[model samples]
Target: MKDSFCVTVTGQSLIKNDVRQIQHKRFLEVLDFLRQGNVVFTNFESTILGRYGGWPTKGRYFDYSRPEMLDALQTMGFNALALANNHAFDLGPAGVLSTLGEVWSRGFLHAGIGTDATDAMKPGRQRHGGHDVSLFAMDAGPGPGNMYAEDRSNGRPPRPGVNQLKTVRKLGVTKESFRTLAMLAQELRTSSLELTNYAQPDDPTAVIGENELNFYGTVFKQGSAFRRHVEIDPENAGEHLAAMQRAAARGDFVLAYLHHHHWEPGWQEVPGWVQGFARACIDAGASVFVSHGAPVLQAVELYKDAPIFYGLGNFLFHVPAEETEWSAREVWRSLVAACRYNGSGQLESIDLLPIVIGGEEETAANRLVPLAATGEVARNILQGFAKRSSIFGTEIAISGASARVSLAAARKVG
Candidate 1:
């Protein structure tokens, strides 16, 4: 094993246009720092295509980048990109294929989508500093069945799509809550058939799949009250676990990443099932488990000597350029996680670098640039990290300009 090596991770990056004009000093400094890492990772949040060639889909916004835009990411030093988010199918199968072609042609390692289910499940491997690091990407975004690739089951050919993990939504509540739901259902005159299986909408194009929203869920008894929970499909989890194990067997280091958009009632907190899912990944042989989605930073948890970043926020926020879907400012706050491991394969350091997103308006020369947060902005970003990670007992202390997370303390139970 190498004495030490760093792995840098970032959240969503959508380069709607070109990135050649960006020249922010601090931002470039951060990019240089990422370039120094053994493996630089980020979520390829948007597709790369010259024009839309796929069937029309249902989404408020669809994002596609020019081929030249890839030069910017390559210049920024992104070695691997995860492509299993909600927008993977924004432009449909043709878009997904185009995105894959662009990334591969650029010679960057990528995971999360493939020509078939087996191919999608395969991990992306890269050698850095003499250490073989493998990356496995999966997404659990809420969508129709077609969002994910399918195996050649029932004598059918394999399908082209993204790697997906299924989520089982359950309603866990007290007796009173169940009674209230029952009363509400009665008021709506909802029949049992409607509750169990929803009727397909008259317009087939209206729904991405058979259904999108799940109002009813299977009930379970937890002591005196009911427990509602959205758990990962055990079979799907097993498949991912097997993939992680296979990667571990072939590589010196393995990292499993997830693009999960599911959040708790309060958007700030991560769903309970995700926490378990992280641990399961670790148990399955992943040295690190990173997650991004929600386009906002969330909590950080260290479980069983492995680190789990629930959400990394947005590293490069340039999407929704045409139609307004999300608050621009809220999506701008972002960070870069630098993880270092010793020769013994133990995590030795984890640093959080805060950044503020800038657009062409801020800098007449650039479209979307992420500058290192400083002064009040730095403090505020670090404070936000502290607040979000505090729930997991991970503390972030201001260390010069960027904040440092004490992984030694994080080694304790979380």
Candidate 2:
């Protein structure tokens, strides 16, 4: 179309009591940057279910901002979406269908969803601004929950939008353990006060699709379990690397989005699995490997001349923004420091967008309030990136727009 501005997309959950509050404002800004034919994409963290599945067994559930949520995305000019985040299946298969229906219906590309693992791991791509991007995703631990297919004759993958773990180690299998695990599951599901699905006193909101709390409780009863290790095939790393080589040979860039939750020192502190995953994906031909689920952000790494965003902190959600929470904000800032941009200041790198939320509940009455600017977060993001660049010995830039960030940076080879 025009030039290539491969926009790596992410948002926590753009659905809440007033999810629409930022749709137009943010979309317009996105369009401003992407007017050259770049694809505007984001993580569809909230489900677009047609029928309500109730709330998650543990995590709170929320529906897409409005049925118009899809419309907004379309209007804003997004071309692709990630259905592999942890919240995709909050409502179950029906929820997956609803989201898939809307996304596909509206003409967007997505990876990580289906009735089984294969489906969930499928690669998706789109064309915008004359560039071609190939994106592949899998539930390293998060989801779109539709990994499983509809065929009942055999064992299928989990839903694309949901992740089906064989068993997680932190999860134990004792009665008290179950209670604790269940509570933990609940916390994971409803971590966000702003977007966590809650039945309103006056609204007709849908319940969460997946019951993360109960889902884990059942896992606890089943005894400590782990994922089946379906063998996403460490060999696939070579295939992807080859693909990346080909894409880079033909196009301006290649990006691979894997379900590597970079936060949670519990897992990532000793993040061997994620490291291997990143190593493999990068080896496959990826220019960048973005992640979420870490809840917190992580440092970036340059592997084979490519950059990896270990994690991107809360992007859509509006935290307290108080000085006490400065570290949380710093996490975003750190991401900005580590991002890659060409000298042009356009985000040349792709980082994870951890927890995107729907609205600005506190600032509804005061339009003049500075908090209303979601896109403004981009400025701060750039500043954060600048601060953290020293830690990684790289040149990255980040800019924030309230809750959003416009990150750009160039790759450095040592």
Candidate 3:
């Protein structure tokens, strides 16, 4: 006989209220499906209060929710959580400590935020269906202070924060654009002509060339225009890869997740580095690569037969009343990814459950809850997924309210 396992991964959850009152028929069906999986994972997108600390006072703005809601989450069948989002440190280290204790006390497994760099970067381990499963999470979004866990430094202690994939950004532009900027700067400096149309760089120093300009180590190749790009820091990304590799070497199935909001021009399209990083994670033995924080549905790809969800959108988002964006149709729609693994630890298939947030009436009285999409809504959601996934040559077939992708059709590499 062969052994198998199943896991369902959802997106960011801003659970501000208890979920015990959920009694709708369609919504209950989705919850029951979630309970059928061996592991249910979600990204906790709010800070758990250690004390009576109210909402954010000075730092970055984020919703503050009571930690008691953990009970509701567990009751809803979420046994695992990723805590590397922007709100993880909204209340500082005490909040993280409280959350760590609460999650552990409730017998829930979580990773990506902790007392220090090591604690935050360590994988959360669980045994399911005669196999060890490890979950490693990180945040690739940009932020300052407490956003990234710090290691011990020269006479400085390690600071508590979230596991981070720090990235280096570079602005790329063509030589023609560089020359135009240089000429403008020269005119601005030589002549006291103050122009508002042409924005000035922080530094007035300009290095212009006929072929190419190397201005203060910022390279400008022969191109058309300017665009910003990012590369994951080698040391930071290497540490995460090593962790996943170690977990796989120990015979534990590894699920590596990241929270990132950096997208391409469109909300659904991701940058090239995201694709590269997902593929590299699979190469390092990750069974799946899950990404969120965009709060919008993105494309899904099969890299090396492992599922890569660029964005899962919101699963349970009930923010403050001022969060008007939640009313948008896109933010209220997402998919629940159910991944099946075979006896040999190879992916067998993927089932996508189309879900719509908000109630059927779409009124203010409707609270935040994910209901199963039916009829036209179901077809549209699945169609959008198929269209986006087509770019990766992955086809999704819709049946009822669910879409599926069998591993047999997934692209394989030599």
Candidate maximizing lDDT: 3
| Model 2 clashing-pair count | 91
Separate clash counts for every candidate: 4, 91, 0
RMSD of each: 5.0, 11.1, 4.8
The alpha-carbon lDDT assigned to residue 192 of candidate 2 equals 60
Distance from true location, Cα of 282 in model 1, Å:
1.3
For residue 173, what is the lDDT in candidate 2? 49
Most accurate candidate by TM-score: 3
Per-residue lDDT for 1-414 in model 3, tens only? 348888898878888888778899888978987886788999988778965343452442566678778888998899989988888877777677777878888987789897888889999998876778898989887655445677888997887778888765456677767777667656765676543323242222233355444444343444567776667888889889988999999888888899876666577777789889988899999988899877788888888788899888888988777767667677878888889888887788889888888644555566578888888888888899889887987878788879898566775432
Each candidate structure's TM-score, on Cα atoms with residue i matched to residue i, is 0.85, 0.59, 0.87
Candidate 1 vs 3: which has more lDDT: 3
Per-residue CA lDDT of model 1 for 89-120, tens digit only, reads 77777777787788888888789988788888
Q: What lDDT score belongs to each candidate, Candidate 1 first?
A: 0.74, 0.47, 0.79
Off by over 4 Å in 3: 51-60, 173-223, 411-414
Report residue 15 deviation for candidate 1 (angstroms).
Answer: 1.9
Q: Which is the better candidate, 1 or 2, if ranked by lDDT?
A: 1
lDDT (0-100) at residue 143 of candidate 3? 59
> Regarding lDDT, does 2 or 3 come out ahead?
3
| Residue 106 local lDDT, model 2 | 76
**Which is the winner by TM-score between candidate 2 and candidate 3?**
3
